[model samples]
Target: MILTVTLNTALDITYRTAALIPHTTHRVTEVVERPGGKGLNVARVLSALGHETVVTGFAGGRTGDVLRELLGAGATARPADGRHGRRGRPRPVDALLPISGSTRRTIAVVDTATGDTTQLNEPGPTVSAAEWTAFLSCYDRLVPGAEAVALCGSLPPGIHVGAYAELIRRARAAGVPVLLDTSGEPLRRGVAARPDLVKPNADELALLTGSRDPLRAAHDTRRRGAHAVIASLGPDGILAATPDGLWRAAPPAPARGNPTGAGDSAVAGILSGLVERLPWPTRLSRAVALSTATVLSPVAGEFDATAYEELLPRIRVTEHPAP
Candidate 1:
């Protein structure tokens, strides 16, 4: 089972407009809302692949209520009784924990003409030390059943920058592998704790390592204490660095659809591969295939089975030359 932790979860609202311009009211051509947060997206993909997944994070407010009512139905708390649920049969655990402040919402305006997205993100609900203490028990209880725990997305206001580092330490103590995914200061701080894996998009990779090339940045990030680093390269695919070697995994060709949540979907593939004890090269190839399938899907966080199956056999995983 894969346990996904989203410290800062939100309801993602996507709008399509003919043209996106600042400070102008434009009629939206379409709109869709989903349980938004990196870990949540990872869990969604895992669930689609028949993996037993449990999701945990800080969710609150009416928006949070909507997410809980929808996404929460799928998560069941780890049993105090101590037994792993069989694969494909997930307990609908309310992995959704409530907080006093409302959860945040992110809006993405997609240009109808070019499919470019302009994102506006809220800072997220401010958390308190007291709330952190409350959730610590939840983390402790869930970590044991977790084969792989993915700590993803940004921290809500008032949550310490080293929050993920603490979680990583706890998971490590319990003999569980952890995957860290976030950005900016939080990511910089979390890397010092030595997560098993960290997946950063190209821009985030460049920012963290100060290298213009993603493959170089991925290798640099691996030196920062992650056992491995996977740099999601959008249409160009993924750049991965493992102890054995570095490789670039790309889909055979562009599938052409919504790119949103592709990186999160890739994270799911990597975690799934980890549980199956697949080779690093297999992990990278599956990640890229899942990411490409996600892009081919109309909905974010969703991958078409047909497309995924088609791409999986064709995803090109090539070794990188030494830097």
Candidate 2:
């Protein structure tokens, strides 16, 4: 089982335009609304893959109600565990646990001309000190049931930068393996608590480690106290560094479709492996497959089962010994 904490959940909105131009109206060809927040996206995929997933974090207001409603409406929206190699069927998940504050929303304008995207994210709700204290109480209730915990996405207003540090400490005490995915100061401070895993995209890794190269950035990121680091490199796939060693996951085939939430999906793949206690190499492959699946999907932070199945066998992993 995996427990996912999305401090700032959102209702993801995607718009399709022939060409994304600044300050111009364009006809949208498609739109998708789902429970977002990085952890929620991972949870959605994990549930489809049959992992037991519980989600906690901040939510309130009508938007929060809508977010939970949307999530509860989606069948098997389980939290990501990173190991999605199960043979049979994934378990179903459609339960909604209440919390305070309405979730935020993320908008993506995808340009049909270049298949590129322009993303706009809400800063999220204000989490008063009392709200933060309340969230921890919810976490306390949920963390005990999970085999691993994934703390993902951005922080809302009123959330102290050190909040993740506190959550990491609690997870450590609970003996639940943790995977954290966020950026900026939250990512910076969260690592000091030594979570089990941190999955950052190339840009976030660069900002966190000040390295242009993803691999080097991942190497340095490990020094921040995370037990392991997995850097998602888009078409470059996932580069991972842990106490075990260093490994690179490269897809043998070209990736097709839009690239959105592939990182969160990859996080799910990684956690799934942790749940299965599979080797790191296998975890890397699963991450690659799940991420690739996300790109193939028309929606952000979503996965295409057919694409994932096809891509899993094609991902290649090369291992290097740790210094």
Candidate 3:
């Protein structure tokens, strides 16, 4: 099973309207709420792809209750006994730990007419020192059973900037491959731990490596400590720099829709491929295809299955020598 960690979990709420205009009152057409945070988003995509995924992190208060409810009645610590039952089918499970502070909410206002998304994100709840200790204990137990782990999203207040780095170390010690998807200082520190893979969007890559060029930034990031770097280039697709070689994967045509969670989908694809032992080119193709399919969906953390199936054969992955 793939284990995903969202240190700062969120209650994702999306508001859809006919048109989005500032300084004016507008009527909302639709509202959708789901359990979110980057790792949860990756878990959702992995689950949709028919993988058994376990999600762990901080959750508390009313929002946390609702998020767990959405995950099903069994989203708790007890079910995470680190044992996969010999059942008929495998499904996604939530093992989020409780905290004192209430979970945060992230709102996305989608303009249906123009397909524009404006997001307002809360900073998330503060985690205490005790809570962090408890989470690490739980994570250690989970890591041994996991085939791979994804250390994702931002660090909440009271948590150390090197949280992901520590988690990566634990996963490595357990002999489980780890993929890190985060930004800024957390990513910088985490990369120093030499994760199996790091997925950073173009902007995040630029911020970390001080290079506008994705290829150059990816290589630089690898040199910093990451075993491999997969830089998301938005519509241009993904540029991956791995020990095996360098490659670029792009969709046959640009997809249009909500871009939020697209990178998470790509992370899911890559992790899924890793656990399945797929080749680098095939893995890159799957990541690009999944990301494109996610862009075609209006909702975050979901992708159009039809689009994914159709685009899988069309994604182009080209290998190049490392610079």
Off by over 4 Å in 1: 21-24, 73-92, 111-114, 321-323
TM-score of each: 0.89, 0.89, 0.93
Instruction: Estimate candidate 2's alpha-carbon lDDT, on a 0 to 1 scale.
Output: 0.80
**Per-candidate RMSD, Å:** 5.7, 4.1, 5.1
**lDDT (CA) for every model shown?**
0.84, 0.80, 0.88
Q: Per-residue CA lDDT of candidate 3, range 1-323, in tens?
A: 99999999998888889777789998989887888899988887787677999999999999999988977642322123323222334556879999989999998898887867889998888899999999999999999999999999889999999999999999999999999999999999999999999999999999999999998899899999999999999999999999999999999988877788799999999999999999999999999999998888645657777789889999999999757
Q: Write the per-residue lDDT of candidate 1 for residues 250-271, one digit (tens) a residue.
A: 8888768888789898999999
Order the candidates by TM-score, highest first. Answer: 3, 1, 2
Model 2 lDDT tens row, 1-323: 78888888888887878987778878999776777788887887787678878777767788788777777666323236534334454432433445455567788888877778888987787777876777788788778778999999888788889888889899999988988898999899988899899998889998998998876788778887988999888898888999898999988775888777788889889998999999999999999998888787655566877778888888999998765
Better of 1 and 2 by lDDT: 1
Off by over 4 Å in 3: 73-89
Which has the greatest TM-score? 3
Order the candidate numbers by lDDT, best to worst.
3, 1, 2
